[model samples]
Target: MEHKPLDQLRSVADVQPRPLSREERLQRWIDLLETDPKRRLSSLGEIEYKPPAERALLREDDSPLTVAYEDPVLRADGLSSDRLGDAMRYFALSDGQAHYALCSCLSGRTMEAGTCAQRLRNATGNVAWESAVGAWLLAALAVSLPGLVYLLS
Candidate 1:
């Protein structure tokens, strides 16, 4: 006789642990960025902007992964004091925080970075959060383009 599918796959008493809180998830993302060698080097000072010739060489559809900036406060909170000093040297303030107000002034456009970060932090779902983060990042980059060019040159 064919055995009936298990009526109850899990016991009623078996409770799944709650999903990670937003803060925890953010921390996890921070930790991943911090630990990965490539990611750790992807922060502002470490990246070299591709030259226009090189950029033209790439396929139109090829997009590089955007690296998230390390949040200074998060690193300080997560690391031991000794490690914190070394870690601090490698990380930058949260990109949203650093560029939020500056971008608005530079671009003659107005949008608060802190507000975007807060909205991203408080977002209840992934899609909204991702969009908020992307908007803030792109705005900041746009405002900084001229400076970036000078620095790279």
Candidate 2:
């Protein structure tokens, strides 16, 4: 005689996975930030910085880092290489909108950069380090002419 198959198993309602502690989450963020840029960029959704319509197009040699350093507007705003590096590093660990903003800022796209700043501001909560980084980025952007205009309007 053929044996009957066992009944479908029911899922356990009480067997939920444990949530990550704050320390664990912070460690994870730090670990992600410490990873390579290509790897980190890939993990964070492979963001591409598109130039806005009103802005002059990017040159063939321009890259995110280069754009951050060489843009006259960004330079006029006093964005040093070190600060830009810090922003890039932080952006790599950040979510999509922040990445977009960082990329736009690097690309000299004022409107998109403003949008990115707003998104970053909305995201500040709970995590102290991330919030501090976000605040620094905001301060950096605020000094830029485009960013100042964005803030005004």
User: Top model by TM-score, which number?
Assistant: 1
For each candidate, what is the lDDT? Answer: 0.36, 0.39
lDDT (10s digit) by residue, model 2, range 1-153: 754433422242334335544334323333333333332121121234343321223222223334344444334444344233343343333534345434443334332323333334444434657778899998887779686687899
**Judged by lDDT against the true structure, how good is candidate 1?**
0.36
Question: Best by lDDT, which number?
Answer: 2
* Model 2 C-alpha lDDT versus the unseen true structure: 0.39
Pairs that clash in candidate 2: none
**Predicted candidate 1 versus true structure: per-residue lDDT over 1-153, tens digit per residue:** 654334453443454445544456454434444344332121122112434344222221111112222444434444322221222223332434323212233323322333333333343236766888999999999999999999999
